[model samples]
Every structure is written in structure tokens, then in C-alpha cells.
Target: MTAVSIEKKVNGTPVASPELGEGRDHPDEEQHTPQPTPAAPSRREEKRLDKSTDRADARLDKAQEREEARRDADHKRETKEKERQAKADRKAQQRADKDKARAKRRKERRTAWTSLQTRLTHHMPMWGLPVVLVSLAVGATGQAGAASAAGMGWASAGVPVLTEGMTLTLAGLTGQAIEQRRPYAWLMRATWITAAGAATINALGHYIEGKAGDPQEALYRAAMYGVASMLGLVLWWVVMRSKRAAISGKTADEVARWKRLGRRHPLLMRRARRVADNTGKSMADAYATVWERANGARPGEPSIREIRASRRAAYRRRLAQSWDGRRGLRKQSERAAAVVPVPQADTVGTPESAGSAGVRTPVQAPALPVALLVPGGQGGWVEHPVPVLPMATPKRVRTGSDQSATARFPQGKDAVSKRVRKSVHDDRLNTVRALVESEAARGCDLRKHPSNRAVARAAGCRPGTARELLATVLAERGITR
Candidate 1:
């Protein structure tokens, strides 16, 4: 509320005093006034201020760290998600591949089954004696009400099993006979005889017991027993397999010697027998001639040493020829040519007429043309036009390695086709696998005792080849030897 007048010289000039005109202070006067100096803070106050400043900086640093941590966690989560997706993709791919393979295999099996059924029908006769006996046996078992129930526990179950088993066995026998070009007719006949004998035995028992019911019931019991007797034939077959009859009625020692020789050089023994039959000479003499030819011994007769040398040479030759594909082809060609027979010249007259010295005129029929010998379209000899055979086209045979590739991929252009083919892979070495597997399925252990020898015999291959194939199969199956 009080006013004081003050004067100051500014730049060597006198300053002016202003009167209060309004409720505002003079801007020039305020700019010229000197303000009071601010006091410095005490040590405690400064410390408190410094602490507050430090806390603010720490809070900002914590916020930045939290942001960085959050980013790192996000990055880890994203990386893990990507890895999981990759793993799942791989598993899905593997599953898809397995499914495709199974589908392809099923298709191939279906086709093979169809082909097998067709082959089976031709090889077996449904109306044969074997079938009749089997039917009769089944009918008897079904009709033998009290007989089956009073027997052992197995009897009731065995009736159906035996029926099915006998049927399967017959089918197998038919296949074996046809595929192996062997005769099983005698075995089938033996089965029938056993069945008949069993029926007779059963009938006699019923008659003796005075339990003979209706004729039909008696026959049923007999038929059931007959089927059971048929099993005896199977046992007999097994026994016969182990016991070999004397070869051509030779003595035991001679047969033993032949077997020993056959084991080493089957070809040599076969040639000796063939030569003996053709020349009407003794086997010993035929063998000696073969030895002489093989050894290049004397022009007249060879010594003991030369004969031994010839035997060794013949063995080596046989082994070498066994591996020679060219030699096998040549032999096949020769056999084919021999099968096409050529007609012999017609005899001018009978031997009796020529020997009698008769001057009678020989009545000769009109000569037939040589072309008449050729087969016609109807598979019969034609006297008019000669039938001409079409030229055979050569087929490409895949070798071992090529066969593996072809079996896997087949010949295809589409990707799906190629994939399907690759899914069901195979190997050329599996050519004998079916034969080996069949024997194994029949409870044969070709890997023990006889080892490769048994497998080779069953598969129709050399022992060495069988061993190699067995190794490959075991390797594929992940089995250790």
C-alpha cells in the first residue's frame, strides 16, 4: 500500500519515475527490478531429491526390461509353434505313405487270389473218390448223434476240423501234383481204401455189440470212422517220405554208392544211366565209357588213374554247365527241335516178300504230299494246303537288378501311378521266395540241420543260391542269423 521513489542511472542516463495509472504494473519498471536470490537446498533435502530422481530412472529402466522380456517370450513361443507344426507334418506324411502301401498290397493280393482259384479248379476234380469220401465222412459225423457225444472231448470239435482240414489237404495235393508235375493219384486212392477199411471196421463193431440201429445210422457211423481212418493215410505218407525203395532193385550197398555219387555229381550219374539204357550195356561199362570220354585217356582203354581224372573232369564240367545260361538255352532248343518229328520214308515192300524172292508186282497206293504232315487250323493233318506258323516275337527278359526296379516302379508316367508302384516294392531275388515260404508255412525248418541244402531242394535252386537268398530275406525282415 506504500510507494517509494527510487532513481538509477542507466547507460549514463537518468531513469524516469512512473505514477500508478491503472491496476497494472509498468512492464519496463518490472524488467528493471532486481529479484531476491533463491537459497540453496540443505544436504538432507538434496539427498531426498536425488533419491526421488533415482527412483524415477529405475522405474523407466524396469519398464524397458519388462518390454524386452515380453518380446523374448513371444519369440520363444513362436519358434516352438513352428517346430511343432514341422513335426506334425512329418508324422502325417509317414502315415499317408503307409496307408498307400497297404492299399496297393491288398489290390495285388486280390488279383493273385483270383488267378490261384482258376488254377485250382483245373487241377482238382470235385467229383473224384477223395471228394466222395470226404462228403461221406462229414455226413456220418453229423448223423452219429450219440457216438460223437460219448467219445472224447476232441471228437465233437474234430469232426468239423477234420472235414475242413481234409478238404484243404486235398486242394494242396492237387496243386502240388499239377505244379510239380508229380503223380498223387496213388496217394488219393490209398486214402479212399483206408476210408473204406475204417467203415468196415466200424460196421463190424456195431454188429458185434448188437447196437445196430437203422441201416442208414449204421452206415453213418461207419462213414465217420472211415474219415478218421483216412488220417492213417497221411501218417503212411509221412513214413514213406523217410523210407526210399531200392533204386532199380540194386543192392543196399550199390544204392548207397549211387546216392553218394548223386549228391556230388547228379549229372554224371544221370548220363551214365542214360548211356546204359541207349546202348543196352551194363551201367559199369557205360560209366567207364563216360569216364574215358571225359578224361581224354587212351584210344582203346584208360587206366585207373585216367578214369579217376575223368571223373574229376566230368564233375567240374557238370558244375560249369549248371551255371551256363547259354548251354541251357542250347539244350532247350535241341529238345524243341527233337519234339518236331520228321516222317520216315515209306517201306517199298514187306520184309517177308523181299526175302521170298517173289517176282510179284507190288501194289503201291498214291503217294501223299510232304505238306500233309503239317498241322492245320483244326490241329489235324491237312492234305490240301500246308499250314504256316507265324514268326515268334522275341520277349524282353528282365535281369536281376532290372527286375527290382521294374517291380517297384513299373512302367508308368503319372506321379500317382509311380507312387503306388513304389509303395509295393519287390526284388528279383524273390523268384524262389514263394516256394521257400510255402515249405516254411508247412512247418519245415530249412534253416537248421540240412540248412541251405533243404531250402535248395525245396526251392529248386543251387545250395549256394539258396543261402544267398535266405540271407537277403532275413536281412529284409530285420532278423539276425
Candidate 2:
């Protein structure tokens, strides 16, 4: 059994047992004491720590919230600012647009004002007025000088009526020169009229004095004065013109105006298209003429009006299909028949004559009734049987020496010659041409017409060639479009 001992020591707790080796040095002491352990903290302490932690957390949250709020506020402010900026920009654009419109209006107004100013300021003289005034002045002045010179003679002779007239003429002439501002050229002409007037006045004054005063001597002196006055007037005119030439630069107001008025009048320009068109020619030719005149004046011959009228008449007649025209054509066709070969009679004894032999008059059938003569009988009925003349086989004459050529021509006197054959071909072509022309006149497109090839074949040419030839012939005659 294990012993349980208790021991106590100063400043030491009781030891219940001593170890074997350590027992000699110190008595054993035994103590049973449980260590004191701290209990769980109070609610208050836990609450304090929790509160501290919570406060830190809260501070962080508050900082985060503040930061986020600030950011949000900043974002809102930025958005508002952007909107405000947009509004401001719109307003600015509106203002700018208004300014632009105002500027345009202002420019228009300025241009209008400038135009008005130009019109308002523009001015020119009345029609030819200044010229007439100058003419009168020059005429009167020259007349006065002549009168003054002749007056001396009259004064010496003492004719009271004449003396007063000479003085009056001189005074009126001097007053006219200073008052008028007419053209110088007119003034020059005025000088001539004035000189003539002065000479006449002087002559009258002297004549009157010669009759009233010392009859014989006065009469001689009067004649001398009249001659002197005329001479003086002529000299005065020469002097004025020489002086005008010597004067340089443009004449004062009068001289400058005279220069302007001196220009040759320009010929009136007007459109000639109406007259040109009225001229008888193709419209294309007329238009070409107009273009020529408009560009350079390498003028072509003007279309003849008479020729046009004639062509128009022909056109009208053709369009109307006049009976006279048809009759004339029939006559032409009959005339053309002269070239066609006549089929000779095949009778054993009938004589072959140019007029007597024809297919239309059948020699074999004598006096057949007109009803029996008709082809494809009336009411589509069969015609009465009558012996009709057979087409005479063309007789060939052996004009050639060759045996081979003799085979084609029989021993007939009326055998066709090469020349005759050519003539017949020409006649057939002419007939075909006439037919083509009639069709063309009916407004057919000859280019595509089926008859055109046949006509061309008869014409011994291509279709286009035939058309070209027809066009040229018609155009030359000016009969068809």
C-alpha cells in the first residue's frame, strides 16, 4: 500500500511524500492545491471588444460608403455637366447659326445698297441738245464780226437804218459764245452759219447806205463792203478750225463731248433666222447658214425664195395627187413605150410593121367581142371560148458571122440586136424607177421595202445604191421630201 504523508515547510506548501534521494536533505511536504483558472470574460468586455471591432469595421464601411457616394456624386455631376455642356453647345450652335443668317442678310443688303448707289449715280446728257446750242453760238459770232467790218463803210456813208443793224448783230454774236456749252464740232459748224449770216447783213447795210448817201460813190463802197464781209467770214472759219487742231488733249467739256459724238453709228444687229428660214432651201441648209453666220461670216449662198416656192408648189401638187399630174405621167409612160420592143405578128403572110405589130392587138383573132376579149370573165364566170393569138416566139436574126451565135437567132428580119436589148433593159429600169418613186411618194421606208431589192435588181445596183440614186434625183428636182 502506498503511504500518504503530509509535511509543511516555512514558505513552502505542504509536501505529502519525499523522494528517496532528496529526503535526507529536506523533509517531505505534501500539498494538494488546484490551480485557479480565469473564467470567461463578462458580457461587457466582450461587448467592448466587439464594439471596438465593429467601430473599425463601421469606419471602413463609412469610408467606403463616403468614397462610393463621392464617386457617385462625381459621376452624377459629370453626367449633369455633360448634359449642361450639350445644352450650352446647342445654344452656342443656335447663336452661331443666327449670326450666320444675319451675316448673309447683311451681305445681301450691302450688295443691294451698292447696286442702288450705282444706278442712282449714273447719268448722261440729253439727246443731241448741247450740239445744237454750240452751232448757234458759232454762227452768230462769225456773223457779228462780218457785220462790224461792213458797218464801218455804212457808218462813213451814214445810212441810219444800216448803222443800227450792224451794231445789233455784233452785240448778239459776242453774247452767244460765252453762254453755250454745246459740242465743239457743232460750234465749228455754227461758225460757218454765223459767217454766212454776217456777210449777208454787212451786204444789206452797205447797200442801204449806198442808196441813201452819195448815190454813185456810196453804191461803189457798198459793193466793196459786201465783198469784204464775205472774205472776212471765210477767213474767220479757217482760223477757228486751225485753232481747234492746234489745241491738244481732249477739248474742255465741249471738245470731249464732240469727240464722243463724232463716232460712227454701229449697224443694228438682229436675228436673221426668220428671214433665213423663209428663204427657199432645205431646213438643214438654212440651219447651217445660221450657224455659219453666228461663228465666222464665211457666208454660204442664201437659199433662193423663188426656187423654194416652186418646190413647195410641186410638193403640194404631188401631195394632192392632181389629175393633170397623173395625165402628164401617163403621157411620159406612153412616150417611154417607144423604147419597148413590139411583138411581131406570127401570121404566115401578115407584114411586120412597127405600129401594126403589138401584143394588145392579136392578129389571129379578128373582131372578138369585148366581153370575150376580157380576162378572168365577169362575175368570175367562164369567158366564151375564142381562139387567142399565141405569143410569137421572138425571132432571132443572124446578124453575127459566128455559127454558135446563129443558133440563138432564127432567120427572122426582126431579130433583136444587142443595142435593142440594151434599150429595152433601160426602158424596164426606167419603168421600175417610176414605180419605186410612186411607192416612195406613198411614204414608204424605202430602206426596208421589199420592192426596193427588185427595183435595185432592175436598176443593176444594190438596194442602198438604188435608194441613193432615187433620193438624189428627187432632191435635184425638189419634188419629194
Candidate 3:
């Protein structure tokens, strides 16, 4: 542990704890004396008995001396602890009492800042207040976030602590700008970019609404949220990008990563990009944490896609049964409809029905011969029949054993669904059976592989289910032979 300096006001001057050693006054002495013996009657005693008694007394004295030493040490420790606690309490009280005054002073300074800021509003026409607030908020927020991260664990804290130092430096520079004639534009931009980026990410989450369903709706919502959230971010970034491009003589969007390394300069776009990237990484971690919570997994655990796939396959099988039977019913309907005779045009009507010359009246039109009817009809009459295109009728087909369809095809090609796609992506199982067969041939033990990685390679099978299926297949084929 690092030596922590605790300031002490021993007299009228402040002294670090190391100087005082937080000294504890020694404990009061405790005496343990041997039991006093009465003068032997007439001073006469056996030599052996007297010697034994003397030895026993010596042992007692040794034990008492050791006990006294231990007691003294414990007492000193306790007293020091008490004094340390007392001093800490006094300091805490002082800080609490002084907090109001500190806050008052801070507020006065902030108000003076406001007045100065108002006077420079037009003078600082190029930038805006949101940028300044966002910068301060980001700097403060980064400081706070880094502090929080530092407390999580050593493995997690190292990089974050480093980043915290970097952010504090940036914030210090930015804070100094509140008094600078011309503030470092990059530092100012860094804060604004950070805030805007945060807003964008938050909006992105709201937009996605989870992958529960309605991809289009989710995408639309995400886009709308992103656009709305980035309105301010976009404006700020554009302004910053423009200024950066002007200074570096590079394009607005481009910034060399090397320039961001240990950056002490203020107007560097690379610095903002670095901080924004760090924020993104943290955001991604938070998102991953949330994902794990929803899925009942720890961080970096594989998604239980096989279990989901099994459930989906079951559901699709059920739907197939419900829907496959409907095809026959549809076929029957089509056959029955094919036999119904189409009505002729003479029995229908003509547009000339309203004429009284050689053109027949509406009452006489129906009596005209079918051939003489001009094979035509009025607007409301039924139109001529159109030839129906032939449909490939569905035959009764079995979904077959293996419950997974890839088994039936000799080439071992993947079974494509006319319905939904599988949960695992295609790259994992580029050649579904080749993966399974080759692994089986090698006598490879999947237990040796990472569960999720192995399962993904097994044609998106659940790790457990895939193991079972492989055993079954091997047994059926006598691979053990």
C-alpha cells in the first residue's frame, strides 16, 4: 500500500501523519507478581521440595513477563487507533462546516464567470454555451467515471486510472481557460464532443429498443433518435472539425492517431477523438453488461443461441404442421372452383341499352342472342374470365428423422428454411456437415473446445444438444468399430 499522508495540526502548524508517526502514548504498566510465600516455619524445609517450588516460580515469572509484553503491545495499538479515529473525526467535522463557505465562494466565482461570459457572448460568437457546459460536464463526468472505475478492481482499474489522469489534465487546462484570454479550442471541443457523443449513444440505445422484434421499427427509431441526439453534437463537431482542419491543413473528418499520443496540446482534434473513443469503449462495456444480464450470462460468455435455436426449430415445426395441412384444403378449393361455368355476355347488359333505335333497350338486351351481344357488357357486368396460371401443387412430404434436415441430403448441404434464418451466422457453419463429419472422423473431443465456440462451429447447435446428436450419430454409424 502507498503511504498516505494525513495532515495533522499538532500545534499551530500542520504536519503530515508520517512526521508525528500518529504517535500513541504508551499503555499504563501492569504488574504480575509471583505468589508470595510465608516464611517457612522455623526456616526449615526439605531440599527437593524447595528446589521444585523454585523452578515452578521461575516458569510463572516467565509466563507473566510475556503476557505483560503482549498486553502492552495491544494497549498501544488500541490507543493509537483511537487517536487516529479522533483526529479523522475532527477533520471530517471541519470539512463539513467549511463546505457551505466553499460552496458560497464557488458560487460567487461562478457568478462572476457568468458576468464575464455574458460580456464575451458576442465577442465569442464562433462558439456556443452548450459547448462550454458540455466541456465542463464531460471533464467532470470523466473524472467521476474514472474514479468509479478505479474502485472496481486492479485488472480493470489500471487503464481507467491512467485515463482519469489524462482527463484531469485536460480538465485542468479547460478550467484554466475560464480565465484565459483565448481558451484552448481543442480542450473546449474535447468536452463538447464527449457530451454530444454520450447523448448519441443514449439515443442509439433508445432507438434500438432491443432486438425483441420489428427490425425495421428498431432501425427507424434508432435513426430518428441518432439524428435528434446528434443535432447538437453534429453542430459542435462540425465547428470543431472545421477549426481543426484549418489549423492542421487536413480534411475535417481525418485526424492522425499519432498526434493524439500523450497529447498536451489544446486544439488537437485527435485528443477529442481519443476521449470519444474511450467513452465508446466504456459504453460498449455497459451495453455488454446489460446484454449479459438479459441473457443470464456473465461478461464474455457466449449467447445461448443453440437453446434458442432449438426452441425456434420446435416452433417452426409446429407451424409447419399447422400450415402444411392448409395446402390440401387450398388445393381442394382450387379444383372445385375450376368446374364452375362462366356466365355468357347476352345474359349480361350493354352500354346501348339506353338507345331506342336499332340499339336495343335495357329490357330487350338480355333477350339478344349470345353471338349478337358483341360479347360485351356494361361497366357493372362481370368481366371475361382470365386463364389461371398452373401452380406446382405441394405433395405430402415427411420432415424425416434426425429432426435436423441436413442428415437426409447426401451432399450434406445445409437445410435452408423458407421461413426464418438461424440464430448463428453463416460464417460459423460454412459447410455444416463437413465440420461435423471431419470433427467426428478426427475423434475430436468438443469438451476440449470453448463451449460457445465449439457449438457455433457445430452448425449452430446447442453445445449440449450437439454433443448428444454427435453421440447418437456415432453410435448409429458404428464409428467405435
Top candidate (TM-score)? 1
lDDT of 3 by residue, 364-476 (tens): 21111122112445545443333223333454354544244332122212233311123222322433345556666788763342234454333333566555544444455
lDDT of 3 at 473: 48
lDDT of 3: 0.48
List candidate 1 stretches off by more than 4 Å.
1-67, 83-178, 183-189, 199-481
**Which 10 consecutive positions of candidate 2 have the poorest summed lDDT?**
264-273
What global local distance difference test value does model 2 have? 0.49
Model 1 clash pairs are none
lDDT of 2 by residue, 373-397 (tens): 2346454755553332323333355
Could you give the candidate ranking by lDDT, starting with the highest? 1, 2, 3
Report each candidate's C-alpha RMSD, comma-separated, in the order given: 28.1, 33.7, 37.2
lDDT of each: 0.53, 0.49, 0.48
RMSD of 2: 33.7
What ranking emerges by TM-score with the best candidate at the front?
A: 1, 3, 2
Clashing pairs in 3: none
Query: Candidate 3 regions off by >4 Å?
Result: 1-235, 239-334, 337-386, 400-414, 417-481
Roughly what TM-score does model 2 have, to 2 decimal places?
0.20
lDDT of 1 by residue, 1-481 (tens): 7766555455445444444322236555443454344566788998999999999999999999999999999999999998999899999999998998898899889989878766544443333336545555654454243335456464555544554455446545644553454666575564545445445544444433334557767666655554554554454343333223321455667767767977876776777777676646577766654544343332254433454468578766554433211234455344334333234456677454566666775543322223334567877876542222222333356566544433223332234334332322232155346545666678866454235665454333468877877777656656445
